[model samples]
Structure formats: structure tokens, C-alpha cells
Target: MVSSFSLFISLILLSLAKGIQGATFTVVNRCQSTIWPGILANAGSQPLDSTGFELPSGETRTFQAPPSWSGRFWGRTGCQFDPSTNQGTCLTGDCGSNQIECNGQNAKPPATLAEFTVAPAGGQDYYDVSLVDGYNLPIVVEPMGGSGGTCSSTGCVTDLNRRCPSELRVGSGAACNSACEAFGTPEYCCSGEFGSPDTCKPSRYSEMFKSACPRAYSYAYDDASSTFTCSGADYMITFCPSSTSQKSANVGPLSISATTGSDNGPTESGDGPLGINTSWLPNFVTGSSSSPIPSSSSWTWPFMIASAYLLFSSF
Candidate 1:
């Protein structure tokens, strides 16, 4: 019974993790011994699915989320070619052709190394902007503020006080406020539910982390009842333990008081069989404009124990 219960708990945690992201890890063996054959046999498998690989008692090395064996994980570089057919390869250099063309739908243009520039017209009432970007791909510049930007707007993010710049809007603020409130304030943007954050924000957050920690995997966990937290050092220089930790509740735990017999404090518990159950406040993260990662929250060991108990009871 205990084993089954433990298995159930493990399954719950694993399931929750899968809902967030799917990845693989590859463990390699550097030892020169056959002491453990089957253990480290397929250590270099694709998807890096396993947590750890067996080793023959030597310096074993492994990587999380190793490149997919089937080539399906082509990533940004894979977009240039069909991974399923092309196998595992990158189309980095030129395509050996000049007058290149891109077909509709799944067509990709060849790669190039070029420079580009965009300048305003000189000594005239017109602008003659030049374009260069190695690839020389056509560039599009739109007036975000409905073409009202005049490069003279005051206290406005854009040229005109009409709209916020795309950078401020968070990749075309089709939602949310464009104004990045005083540097440290949460930039509330528009969402499908109006006056809420959007999925695009998280995607942008992922991009920021990738830029900051290119090698390490980045995860943004939000339990609604808990605050937004991260898994790194105070400045990203040192590494924090990858294992999960506790996060304090903005509103502390409930405590029973003898006073009203029905009410204690804001977070106090009461002994009334017929009384309503007051819920704890939902956890939240005050996101910042400059950083993609929200503030970190530290959890307590006691809370973790209680959580484990609650989950076990449910099972």
C-alpha cells in the first residue's frame, strides 16, 4: 500500500511537470570499464528522456534535453529544412544559388551574411532609407501609433502620444497597457480577458531567459496561490539548486484564536462545523518590463511536508 501510494504521488508530480514542458536528457559514460554494461548501454539515446544513465564506474557525463535522435527537434535552425526527410543536419551556409526564391506555405529562403542600414532622407522633404541585413530580406516598418509618430512626442513611448512602442507593448501590445509604469511596476497588458496578461508575455519571458541563460533550461512556475519564482542566483552568476523549494504565502497561514469563537484574524482558523471555509489568497508574481523573470519566492520545508500529506490523502 505504501509503495502504491508513493507511486501515485510520484505520478502526480510527473504529470504536473509534463503539463508545463516536455524535454529529454542524455547521460554519457566516460569511464573505461564494462562493470555495468546494460546500465550505460543506451546512454546516448534521443529525447534525453531518462534522468540519469548507468556508467561503468568512470567519469560519466550527461546532458538534459539532448538533441532529438529523429531530427524532429530541429529547433530554430531546423525551420530551414524538413527534419523528417533531411535527417539531422543544419542548413547554415549558402545554397550555392544566386536568384533565390521562397515557395508559399512551408518554403524557406536561403541564408546569407550581409549588413543593412535605415537612414532618413537628407536635405529634402522625403526619406531615402537603405536596407541591409546579410540576408537582405525585405523589411517592413509600420507607424505603431497609427502613423502619428513625428519623432517629437513628449512623455510618450512612441513618436506621438497615441500608442506605446512595440518594444514597450511587448511584441505588438494587441493587449495590455503599453506604458511600462515607472521601471519597477508591473506592466499590465491587455489579454483575451481584458486587462490581463497574455501567453505572449510568457513566450517573451522564455526568450529573455534564453538570452540570459542560453545553456540552462528555463522554467516559469505559477501556482496561482503562490508567487512567481525562479531557479537561479541573486544575479544569475551562481547557480541555485535545481530541486524545488518552498514559497511563502503573501498572507500567512491561519491560526485559531479564542476570541470570536467564529473568527480569529484574517488568516485564522475557526471551529464551526457549519461555517464556510475561507480560502487563501491566490499567489501572484509582479512582473517587470526589463526582466522576463519575476521575483523569486522561497518556500518552507514545513509547507512542503504538509503539501505532501495533502496530496497523499487525496490519493
Candidate 2:
């Protein structure tokens, strides 16, 4: 009887361990100002903990993502939220939900986005720090302790807002607007006749963003260079990651494999790479939900297993 009970307990623990296998995202705000980190899971996917939360400067928070999770994350600046009404707005990267938690809402463009698709096909995590929406903050996505395939750190380390074109500038040195956002033309927005990569060529405006951040998506068609793949890795998303002037510059150690030679060099149009075809995947819908399911569901099985183990031992 004792042997059978021990075997059952062992099986339960093993199942519990397997259930928790997934990726963790450590979000850090290294900026001198406060930032509210926002998360938007892909439509029909399980949401993570608190879609948005206030992250004071120099603070860090970690959240787990279930297997095959896909989403985008951005930092919101200058926000004021009220718990009573659950309504508010942010100066930059606002989801316009009138609340702290985005609750499945996507950020308005002109905000830098850290996009991710974990455990996608081929067992690799595809990720990128995209400026295609535009630029608001200096963000970095560093993969930590992952095996298989080159896990390179990708982000816009340079402050694009400082060098934004006069016409494409948003606020007084706040965020840089994408050419699409600035002009809204078919050529700039990559819509209508110019939707294809051959038609919608890189403009001089996008070149500025590409020059500043080669590893990030400067436009909608940028994929080959910007998309990085890593297997079984936790990611660190840092906003305003440590500049030389700050004492708390060293947040943590990072390991980056060198980018593939195919996409490393600059192109004729100043885009990171050329000759890469653009393939359209099913798009994730961006909207809002009132109540999202909690992420604590993963822990329930473990708790129940522990209780069962204790009960079996007592016998």
C-alpha cells in the first residue's frame, strides 16, 4: 500500500512539473521616469497577469507565458488611472481602454513594441523589438539561457526621438512617428496598390529609423533581420536600458549570438536586409475585454497535487 501511494504521488508531481513548462518575461524599467507596462495577448489566447501595471523607474516585474503564447508589449508613459472607475489614459502608448489593465487592448501606434510568439512552429520562439509602429522609448529584448539556434538580442538602443524628422515628430521630443503615421499615404502606409513589398519600397523617412536601429522593424515588411528565434528561453524586456550616465546601468548580464551574415549588413535602401519575401500570417485582432482570466490557473494543479501527496502520506 505504501509503495502504491508513493508511486501515485510521484506521478502527480511529475504531471505538475510538466504543466508549468513555459516562458517567463522579466520586464524592467530602467528609465528615470515611471512607466506602465502594457500586455496584449493574441485574440483567443489566454491572457497573462494584469495586462497593465505601474512600474516605477528602476523596478522589475516578471510574468509567465503559457506554451505557444503570442502577444505584444509596450511601455506607457505619463498615465493616470483610478481604481474606482478603472479608467485612465496615457500620454504615450495608450490602449484607450480608460483603465490600467489593457484587458486585451492593443496600444495605439507611434509606440515602440516588443512583439513575441513563443514556442511557435519548429519549437523556436520568434521575437522582435518593432519600431514599425513608431518609437517612444529605447527598449531591448534580451534572451537569457536558451539553447539551440542563435538567440540574438534585438532592440532600438538608440533614441530615435532625438533624431526624428521634424514632420514625423510627435510631441516635443517624446516619440517619433512612423512614415505611415505621418503621411498616411499608400506608399507610406503600405496599403492599396503599394501593399506589396515591391510596390511599397522603403522611404527616406523609414531610412532614418532603420539607420538608428538596424535590428528593429522599421516598417511593416521588415521581417528577416528583425525576427529572432530562440528555443526555451526567458526574455528580459527593458525600457530605457541603462545608459552610460546612470549608476544603475548594469541591470543584469546578457548573452547574444551574432546575427546571421545574410541580414547583418545594410541594404541599398538603408533597410537592414533585402531579397527577403514578406509572408502574411493570420493577424492577431486588437481589442478590449472587460474581464480577463487570471494567470494563476497553472498553480492550481500543483496545489492539488501537494494536498493529495500529504493525504496519501498520512495514510
Candidate 3:
């Protein structure tokens, strides 16, 4: 009985960790206008259904990715394309493919991005909504029909395009630029001495972003609370997700109490979660925005432990 139980427990653990081998990503365009969505698989990962496509308002599409696959998804705005020859230009998030499909091309700057790394067998998939590149629109990645706990929803549900600082704002406020993309400094870009987590620090501009979207990656090193994990779950990637008029809830383990525009507290250029004074920022860098970023609630350790307890109790 003991041997049989041990083998059964091991099998159950593997299933819990791997989530039925792969995952399905459902992309929904909830924006007011039509937007072009782009996809790019990581170097070694298999391709999804389409590299790029037109998602009209209120339309929904889905893609399936194999286990161990990794890639990014983003949206392009103000696009004018010719389906006949598959050519066009976008005001933001263009993959530079000059056509409808990204064809392995990555999204250009000023694009809100959703990234994922589906786990191989016996592993937990990782996902995040990043502002490391910049923000073109609001987005939310909700894990579908899975056990709760750390497997919760995440993403930037705010229209950061409107609140974008003047210097970082793209033409007509179509997208917002990250400080790193705007300045290209080692400090803002988290390169050189600032490359490591210990040396890098968030700039005032990044603080402003953190203030607006508390759960997103405000800067390059914003990792502790920026990444999430899950097993055996599908995802709903919603573009222009409804903007919530509230500050994000406090982080569970990190105890990060962040405030947003809706909250009655500090504004962008003031003290918030970082505990760093945000009185001033360098003169904003003016130019076209460049590409990339990360979210979440808990680590997988607890989930595994919970699974173990449940399995043992059943035994």
C-alpha cells in the first residue's frame, strides 16, 4: 500500500506541475477600434497559430502552444494594411514585417506586452504582463478554470497611454515610452553597472509607471512581484481590458502597498511603494519609443505543499 501510494502521489505531483502538457491562449480584442496583434516565439520554441492578425473590436481568437514553448504577444495601433499584398504600417507595436503577419518579427517599441514560458512536463508555466518595453494599451491575462491560490489574474488594467508623461508620450498619445527606451542610459536601461538586481534602481519615471499599474514590471529589475506561475491552465489575453478605477490590492508576500491615480494618496512623482523619494526626474528624453516588460500573487512552493497535503489526506 505504501509503495502504491508513493507512486500515485508522484504521478499526481507531475500532473499538477505540468498542467496537462500544454496551454491555450485566448486573445480577445476589447478595444474601441481595430488593432493588429503580433506574436513572436522565442528562439527555440514552436510557433503558435498565427504570427500576426487583425483583431477587430469585440472579436476573439485563440492559439495553442506546446509545453516548453516561450513567446510574446502585443498589439499594434493605427495600422493601415493591404491584405492583398500583406503590407502596411502601424503607429505603434509594428513588428517591422511591413505586412500583416509578424513572421517571427518582434513588436517595435511602445507596445503593451504579454509574455509566457509554458513549462515542460512536471513544471509550472510562467507568465507576466510587462511594461519593460512600454505601454500602448491596457491588458489583462486571466488564468482560466484553474485552482485559485497563487493562480490568479494579472495585468495592467489602466489606460497608461493617457497618463503618460509628456516627454514619453507617443504621437497623439497612442503609447507611452519606458525611461530606458527614452534615455538609453545605463541607469534607466539597467545595463552596465545597473545590470544586476542589486545595483539597479527604479528611476522617477519608472516610479510613475509603478504608481499607475502596481502589478506590472515598472523597471527591468522589478522581479519579486512581477512574475507568476501556474500549471494546467488556459489564459485569456484581453486587449484594452476594462480600466479599473482603483489602486491595486496589496501584494501578498512582499507587503507592497502601492497606490494608483484612483487612490487618494501620492501621485506619480511622489513617494509610493519603492520607499525612494520621487521628487524629480531628469529632463524627459524626447523621441520615438522602442520595444518590451512582467505580474502576479504567489510562489509555487505553497501550491506544491498544498497539493502534497491533499494527496496524503486522500491516501
Compared with the true structure, all predictions reach lDDT values of 0.21, 0.72, 0.73
Pick by TM-score: which candidate is best?
Answer: 3
RMSD of 3: 11.0
**TM-score (C-alpha) between model 3 and the true structure:** 0.73
The regions of model 2 sitting more than 4 angstroms off are 1-20, 83-86, 120-122, 245-315
Better of 1 and 3 by TM-score: 3
- TM-scores of all candidate predictions against the true structure: 0.15, 0.72, 0.73
For model 2, what is the error of residue 187's alpha carbon versus the real structure, in angstroms, after optimal superposition?
1.0
Write model 2 residue lDDT over 1-315, tens digit each, in one string: 776677677666654442356678888887888999899999766999879999998788988888788899999988888868868899899998888889888998789999998884338888998988888888878776555775867787666665566787787867878889988889888999999987876676666666557778988887777889987677778897635323333332121223321233455553433221112111100012321112232454566677667766776
The TM-score ranking, best first, is 3, 2, 1
- The lowest-lDDT stretch of 10 consecutive residues in candidate 2 is 278-287
Model 3 poorest 10 in a row by lDDT: 285-294
CA lDDT, candidate 3, residue 108? 93
